[model samples]
Target chain A: DAGITQSPRYKITETGRQVTLMCHQTWSHSYMFWYRQDLGHGLRLIYYSAAADITDKGEVPDGYVVSRSKTENFPLTLESATRSQTSVYFCASSEQGRETQYFGPGTRLLVL
Target chain B: DQQVKQNSPSLSVQEGRISILNCDYTNSMFDYFLWYKKYPAEGPTFLISISSIKDKNEDGRFTVFLNKSAKHLSLHIVPSQPGDSAVYFCAADRYNSGGYQKVTFGTGTKLQVIP
Candidate 1:
């Protein structure tokens, strides 16, 4: 509604399948980020976008792809989901040059 | 290779007591630090933050202390309440060659406040 949101709060997919997680922000923040939360790794960044057309890779980007066609939307896609990719994904947004981020409810994905 | 590390996986403190969460970083170039709180099935919300230029930053019931030399930071909550029980994450940020700042998060610490 007002803040940020992620679609398919929960999803289950088969291995080698393709899946996409959607993130939308109403604040129009310049920076949007995608992160995966795992057991030992609290939250590892997958990708981040500086603007509508500018995206960059983060620590863990090997299996993830992100695109920002519009300022309010940043979607993350898994070309071929694997079992190791199963985790809770969070989307965050912030103003340019600011480290403080606002996150979405997150999508819990399971790859079987 | 983890720049930010939160060694304590969990902590418990009695109501009305002070809850301290510590975090350490190995990167000497980190210029900013932040703390976030996340509840069950909820996203992390920004709690408090401090810059390398400042040693401490305080809010209502929360205060963040930073030690640049030791490469450590802490979040303290006074008069801990049950509502404060949640997973707290420590994050660090440093500007890279790119124009944007790259932020890294710690493993997080689950703080439980007993009522």
Candidate 2:
């Protein structure tokens, strides 16, 4: 219970519906990241937050929106889910930039 | 384009033998590199890492070798065991990537240890 945790480890949603993946870390790390893992693409960063109210887009952030209102939580929302959005989402946290990150179990989202 | 590349999709090695997993990078600005191992239903955990300044770094049975000139790196596991079977990802740190210190990861290589 001391490490990072993601809500709804498995999710099923219809296309065009909105889905939000929640990530909470108890460590209060300075940097939080969201990544999606897909076949042939590995893990691509979708968004990252340096601290509360500070967030930036990553490699593939077009279809996703992220917000960090609290230091302990960073949530990712898919405005209009599509089949291409079906992938495993991971949340990671680090104390500093370019440091070792601790990851959560991951949330598997399927868009039908 | 993929900044980090792991050409091998999977590899099988006999138990007690050495297992080699390789990675290549296209970016010359990467100053740090890391390897992560992941099992099904679990998040990836850091395995080992080496700085561009050093050619090698070792921890227990895991060792990471970085060749800055060739833009290549590798992870070698000695006495490979069945427990070592998992997906391994190589990551590179782009420190100057807009202050975020973005890490580009390879697709990953799955290693299987046959007894």
Candidate 3:
């Protein structure tokens, strides 16, 4: 519980279904981020939170939603999962702006 | 548009040789750069980082060189080891209005250090 962790390391779901990926960190970092990695797109930021109750969209945030109700937890949800959404999702946290981030083990999602 | 780009999809080098991975970025405003290494089933872990004010940074056997004019950077691992084989991603960063840094990552370059 000292490092960042992502729940449900692997998940399989059909298109149009909703799925949520959970992330928790014990470092109490003020900055948390969610990213998705694909074959040709290394790591695309989906969303980020600066602090509890303060979240903002990132480059690839069209189909995903995120919430940060607590400093230790940030969850991402796919409103309508699509085949294109199938990719490895990573959660990262940093102490402050411009600080190096520590990543979670990642969640491998498959949308059929 | 992809701001950070790693043109080489893969590279192979013999152990004890120098392994170099290149990256380029379109954005000139990026203030910081970082490299992340990822394994088959694990998420990426931070390897090295360089600030825009410096041209080079080194740690142990790893070194990162930055060229601001060319918007290019490279990571060099001397005497590469077989255990060093992994996918490398280059990322550019800048502090956003949200009081957090925003990162743009490259497609990644897979390096294979053969023994």
Q: What is the C-alpha RMSD of each candidate to the true structure, in Å?
A: 0.7, 0.8, 0.8
Model 2 TM-score is: 0.98
Ranking by DockQ: 1, 3, 2
Instruction: Report the error of model 3 at residue B64, Å.
Output: 0.4
Per-residue accuracy of model 3 over A2-30 as CA lDDT, tens digit each? 89999999999999999999999999999
User: Which stretch of 10 consecutive residues in model 1 chain A shows the poorest summed lDDT?
Assistant: A93-102
Compared with the true structure, what per-residue lDDT tens digits does model 3 show for residues B52-111? 999999999999999999999999999899999999999999877655689999999999
B1-114, model 2: which lDDT tens digit per residue? Answer: 999999999999999999999999998988999999999999999999888889999999999999888999999999899999999999999765467768888999999999
Docking quality category of candidate 2 according to DockQ thresholds: high
Model-by-model DockQ, in order = 0.92, 0.83, 0.87
Give the best candidate by lDDT: 1
Model 3 regions more than 4 Å off:
none
Clashes of 2: 0
Model 1 global lDDT (CA atoms, 0 to 1) = 0.96
What TM value does the first chain of each candidate achieve? 0.98, 0.98, 0.98
